[model samples]
Target chain A: MKDMIMSYSDLSSSIREPWHMLLFILLSSWTLLLCVAPPATWAESDKITIYSYSSETSINNFKLLKMEFDSYLSRFGPYELQPVKKREDFERYTKGRKDCLLLISSWHFGNIGQTYSLKPALVGLRNGKKYQKRILTGRGASANVEDAKTARIASAASDLHTKEALSEIFKGKDVADRADILTVPKDIDALMSVSLGMCQYALTTEGSLEDLKQVNPFLHRSIKVVAEGRKSLLLILAFPESSGKVRENMMKLVKIVQHMPLDPDGRKKIKMFGLDGWQPFDSSDKLTKGD
Target chain B: MKHLKLTWLFCFFLIVSSAFAANRMPKVLLINSDASVSKYGEVQEAFKEDIPHPVVGVNLGDEKWDMPSVENLLYDEYPDITYCIGSKAYHIASKYIGEKDIVFSSVLNWLRLPLTRKTYGVSNELHAEMQIMLFRYIFPDVRKVTMLYSKRYTQELFKNAKDKARNMGVEIAGEAVFKGRNTISAFDRLPADTDAFWLISDPEIISDKKGLSNILKRCEKRNLPFFSYHEAFVKLGAVLILSVDNPTIGRQAAGIAKRVLSGNKPAKNVEPPAGSHIILNMRKVKAYHLKYNENALGSVNSIVE
Candidate 1:
């Protein structure tokens, strides 16, 4: 009985087939190759997702912007220009996601940073300027702040900055009651409302007004600025709190922003974002309470 | 043989007389309100290109000359035609240059100016229908537009805008703000549904800074966009403007001069300037948050940021 068991064990031995030796050698060679491979190629699969809030931005425009940014960052390697356009898409993409990047308005940055504690990577700079002022424009006579109590006002809906500024301007008065306020989703609508006499006045930013002038030259002569409001940074970029490879990549991207591309193609890409170049975001550049 | 000799002498005589006739070219007098205003140079250059006859230019407001002296000069020169530019020059030349063909230009509100059979003018104001058409082109979504005008200055324009606006499916609501009446409050009472404020270049309505400020404030309170006749008003927050192009107007005047020189009966009524330009302020577009119509924006002459 012992001799029969020994013969069976030998028949089933691992070296019974030559193919088993070849499989062992292949496995060892693969393990060795993985161990010796460069870190960059190893980390090629890791991706950083970018998201922009859909306020006035359209999906196609966002996609174009993504392409521009992706092309600019191609030299950096291992980065994807995956831009999330909608608010829901952003939430869904950002939920429990690691190594993510966010492009947010200064207003949203302040609001979201309180909970997530985001670290800014770089902020957009326009014509070498960083701050903008909110203002009230109306017909020449009734556009002033003093007349706002009884005036019909146009404002952007869901815009916290404009709301806050209006609150401060009409602090003592019952703004909700005294002023007949109409809220629209975009700044251009509010301005058109004022221009068309649908409303008496509008609240907007100086930079926004300048941008509007580029599209509607008639508004330059038609809208009279009645009052000025608080100043603030327009846009900012942030990285998630847990810093790792993303932070390193973000640092490199920030360096690129600091020294903007001089080529015409790079310039055209940057101009779409209303910026001539990028600037480092320091403590001084951080948003203040009123700003 | 004697008859042949007589015929040759007569032929020589006819040749010499024809040469003498060629030397006596018609004279044209060019009178400008302010010749130093560089735009007049453009007018002069354009006029010369079209009118080949000899021209004598007179600066109406020159310190070296007065209306009486200018009158004396006109009588002395007895020019075949007089070209008057600007309101001052037009008025002076009309009074001083007697009966000679007069072609007037660079004059604002030429419609109100006195017209004679011998005097034809190119007015700064375009036809009301043209302005209304442009407004419709720029703001297709707008249904109603409001204008504040003094009857003395803008009665015809107001009528024309109203008639044309109706045909174009747009409505024009105008308030007649008479001279010396406190017109500031008139802006406050603008139609609530007004899609835009049309500002006419009436001195009675727009000359007062305080009144203009009040009107602008009211527009702000109501969110009504402003439109105007002057490009300068764009800086004051007007969204759109249509103004006469001086050089183009000058060329048109020269064309009229050619017609008059060819013995065509000079028109007894003032005609709108042949050319004008549209200025758009896109900043106001952002301030009001209007939807950008790329197709409409493409038609504008100049866009201001």
Candidate 2:
């Protein structure tokens, strides 16, 4: 306590000892404070704070964010990385704070940019329904691969987004051009179509398809992620770079992101939540399509 | 005084037993989830005969019973090291293995093992999946593979295998309801154009290769290729990508033994089970008149063809 007071003490104190000596003093004092103080000290405090942006919060995004927050705290000091569940809290954190990083979906990202000063420095691959014409099918369906025969391929989209993505998967040869695939409007409808024998297939998000049986245990008996063709940047980590200090947490966050490979749930959640990675920048950088 | 002299003589016997006790060795308690210890039977026999210690084997099936209850009594009756043999047994042993290092064996879900506990076990080792995926890769035309399970324990290897297969662009055809009903009628109608039948870890359906062999005969009659996760299932009839390699499981158990014997704190020392070795047999492949990639032959532990 004396040394810490001496190190950062009032103007008249000593300057001879190493700061590390002061660190130990502060450490012991803080440990003593923690032990002596009320339990609330462990909760939100005046110390470092972390704010993560969540959109349409799900278990996947929540977990990965928590893991990253823990990793950040372990590296830096023990700071509170508070996860705000709704966009309203997110708005509050960013407006009053310069240290917060915001993550939003692609649909909301454009709105965030138009209404707020946040910039997108990272890109998340959007992996759902990459094709409008592509229809996911079941195991025991009889269909030829010719384009004329492909309309039987059923998905939610009446258009050909699924078809285009499937074509891209086959390198623009157009699997639909070569085969007949029917399209649908929604994933659930497509899943039901195939499961109920209405159609042979459905176009759905990988995460959604993977968890279908989780919601309906009997669903997995007849459904699964058959072919992975859709991929896009659906999530971006945006922070108001107008302020110089905005990059402070974002930089550490970027550094933290690079090393999160060991956390599969984090990676999977990042994918499921439609976000790519954290990008640190000054507000001057443009958050645009060129990215 | 006479009784005291007799006690002293008995004390001398105890000293000899404690000192030169080659025959009366330190007892090690091994518990398993099933009476079919054959899965880990060989290793248990090796531990009993090879170790300078005595190993007592006990079995408790997959129901809530007094395993740890018996274990507590055993620890009191005889001071012994407990090597839990299966996943459930390990959990039962966890209740009592405080401050004692524990070795785990023949368990599939290593992730479920308490990371804080000193645990290590055999992993399913992605061998079966890799082999089957490779088979799908070599035979890109194969769109669907069928997996049959007893109504009981359908959760077996379906999810893991299903994900890997689907990701590899192969379709999975699954049918269940094997719990207590012995209706093989599910296979009465095999879907045509089904390329292969992948056997998974359903002991109720296929206890051994021969049991799977009868199923393979049915599959073969339909001109369908057969593959299995269990190695012996391949030897029986299903041309397999892997048979559960118990020896690799033994080595994994030994690895845990090394950790336990070395006195690493059990709570902090539990690690994932080492992966299993895929043993592909070709005689079964030849019987089915199918040509697997030559690469699969290289990975086969025993190939009859």
Give all candidates' CA lDDT scores. Answer: 0.67, 0.51
Worst 10 residues of 1 chain B by lDDT: B292-301
Candidate 2 residue lDDT tens string, B1-305: 99999999999999898778554444567776774667667545534433344556677763554655676665674534677777777776776654555667667646567744444444544333444444552344567888776644555456666776665567787766364244255565446678787766656765655555567678767877776565555555665554344533454355345435545433334432222233445565565556544322212334433
Each model's DockQ?
0.01, 0.01
lDDT of 1 at A232: 65
The alpha-carbon deviation from the true structure for residue B227 of candidate 2, after best TM-score superposition, in angstroms, is: 1.7
State the lDDT of candidate 2 residue by residue for A79-132, as single tens digits: 445665556776666674555556565435655665677666554433322111
Candidate 1 per-residue lDDT over residues B160-260, each given as its tens digit: 87876676678888878877275876666667887888888888897778888888888888888888888778988998897655655565566567667
Docking class of 1: incorrect
Score candidate 1 by TM-score against the native: 0.49
